[model samples]
Target: MKKTVILGTLLLGLALGGNAQTKTPVGSIGKNDPKAKAILDGVSTKLKSLKSLVANFVLKVEGGNSKVTDSQKGTVYVKGQKYKVLMGDREIISDNKTSWTYSKDVNEVQINNVDQSGQSMTPAKLFTNFYDKDYLYRLIGETTEKGKVLQNIELTPVDKSKNIFKAQVDVDKKAQTIVRMKIFEKNGNKMSYEISSIQPNATVADAMFTFDAKKYPGVEVVDLR
Candidate 1:
């Protein structure tokens, strides 16, 4: 269960970074807010034009009774339906059909089938139109960060039973890219990710999304499929 939760969280973050090209229709939650749709549409348009992307990010987690804060840095590479993510001593590689999660600390790798449900969250759906379904979103306000204008948008899950209560995204107006995102969980945990750098249309080979077991000596392989 712990691994499942961790994988779910990581996949959610990847989904947020995924791509969407079509215009998202206003859902019930955001039907009254045209401004939010407009801003999100702009982001979608920008993401649709990119063939691939590489981003360096900082993740921060806060909350819980101890109020302890933790921070980590990671990198993500996305090309169409494929992605590779590295964080700490762990790496996730997926070719949109199969996924391999390797943990250097444990010297193990887990293989699993890709989830393709209608409600599935994956890297390929991140920036695209994933937001159009599960959550109700609206433009909250705007702010300036490092001289760049940012539009802040808040999203609330239509299903109250979701572990995530709300999410806040800060989109860079000029670049039409997401610079930051904060997710608030029902369990009182708050997680935030800031994109420190981004390279759009990066050249990434397909092999980069597959795990080669021979490269890792004596690593245990767990097949969960």
Candidate 2:
């Protein structure tokens, strides 16, 4: 369940890579700002134009009562509906049919059916148009970070019952892509995922998104499907 929590935190940030947990259907939160919509549309267009994508990111988990902060560097390979996320000792792989969650520390892999119920945000939808129905977004303006102009967009989930109440996405103005994402949860936790590097139209194989037990010696498979 710790892995699920981490994945939800990761994917929810990426989905807001525009943002996951399941909740009631959203009602109209407010009118979507035209400026924000156009910026997000550009990101969607840029993503759809790619054949495959490889991105290196850093996820920084902070807040809570603890004074310490945990940071993990991860790589994500996405091709169509398939994706493989490698973060720390855990790897989350899905082929749009079956999902695999592998934890290296335990040397075990958990398999489950990929739920395409549109209730949760999958990796494939990370760079797509998921914000349209889920949240109301507004452009919060722009700032220059190390010479790169960044556009900031604030998103509020229409479904109040969701764990995450708000999210902020920082876009690279010239590239029209998400550079960083920060989410504020109802539990007083703040998570930030910053894209360190991105490769559009990267060369990636389909095999990367599936769990091959043979690759790991003495591994245990737990199929929950």
Candidate 3:
């Protein structure tokens, strides 16, 4: 379940940000597919224009047999580099500098400094520009559902050693929003998330991204930094 929360955070970040910068060159593994670029650009433009966003999502984890082993629902709020996520008994709050991960089941909160190097899978990088660096993207296909057309794009990592084998992103062409993302892992596990609903340019307060320990009277705070 910890993995699920971590992946959920990545998806939320990726869904809300745009404009990527990469330290390492994309090299030969990356492709210049115009069709895929156009679709991704549209989604990126739409997300970047939003001042803030609130989204409800459904996450499903599938086993090697292609059976869904676990399913959960969650909510995420994003404003700039800050985000707050709630999934089951866990809540992760980040203000782009510090992060607080609270687990209700354990009655503990873990505090740590945020990763800003842009090399790691931090929420800021994923939301802003992580795709620009290590990914080679191509347009896979297109489909329609509920009268909405969606363009599907597949992204493969430039580094073969990465645990994420491939990432499939579905964008709603008309809405210019990401509707779903499916991540295929090297371990034969599949994780997918669907955006059920979203409110763009939401009025979110900065304090929402910070964890107030005073609210949790008896919770243990573990400062890992």
Candidate 4:
């Protein structure tokens, strides 16, 4: 008798899920829609004003139904093609020509020139020229999260393999920012990033993107070219 009840409950749940999925309107399902367009415009407007931004954030992640938290304090410098991410006593610098990742723990730095693809959190790429880039966009349906309104958009690279997520990205519309990002890999591993306490236009220096070899005495430089 108990087994029968459980099976009935499961069947009912599936029925409800199917109904909800079919109920969503198709007009808001991709980019160029009124709501999604406004969202992209708002995000662009917010990014254009930011010359350089520094923010201290804590990442809250849920892996395997368990909650894990990590704190990252960093600064981003956006001066044309030059960009840098300084965090946790380490720094990644792209000096408009060559890029290097400096690590104090391993006592070495990695250097590469003209490797400006598939990396995240790039101020110049993510900010100034976001919408202008060649991305296939869709509305991604309604904007709601946990019963609240959130900007939702789906983006796929023109080249299928370039984008890890392939399916879509959920954006928070009212905040004009990315609430969380998800990347689905073929091997059943999904990487997620939730943004918090992002302060834009914070006072940052251009020197932050410069790599001074003399400044660091002993370090290993790994060039991944």
The candidate that wins on lDDT is 2
Residue pairs clashing in model 2 are 14-17, 15-19, 16-19
Quote each prediction's TM-score: 0.85, 0.87, 0.87, 0.67
lDDT of 4 by residue, 103-205 (tens): 7787788786754463333445555434435455656555445564554565555545542434344555566665544443344433444444565666667
Once fitted onto the true fold, the runs of candidate 1 whose alpha carbons sit more than 4 angstroms away are 1-32, 65-68
Would you give me the overall lDDT of model 3? 0.73
Q: What is candidate 2's CA lDDT for residue 49?
A: 83
Error of 4 at 222 (Å): 4.1
- What is the alpha-carbon lDDT for the whole of candidate 1? 0.73
The residue ranges of model 3 lying beyond 4 angstroms of the native Cα positions read: 1-5, 8-29, 122-126
C-alpha lDDT of candidate 2 relative to the true structure: 0.77
- Poorest 10 consecutive residues by lDDT, candidate 2: 15-24
Q: Per the 3 Å backbone cut-off, how many clashing residue pairs does candidate 3 have?
A: 2
lDDT of 1 by residue, 1-225 (tens): 133333323322211323322343444543536787788888878877889888888777778663538778888888887888888998988898898999999999999998877466555667676677777887766776557677778788777887888887777788777777777877787776777788899998888999999999999999999
Q: Write the per-residue lDDT of candidate 2 for residues 62-129, one digit (tens) a residue.
A: 77763327888888888997888999999999999999999999999999998878667766776678
For candidate 3, what is the TM-score? 0.87
Whole-structure CA lDDT of model 4: 0.50
Model 4 alpha-carbon drift over 4 Å, by segment: 1-35, 57-80, 87-90, 115-121, 129-134, 143-148, 222-225
Clash pairs of candidate 1? 15-126, 18-126, 18-127, 19-128, 20-128
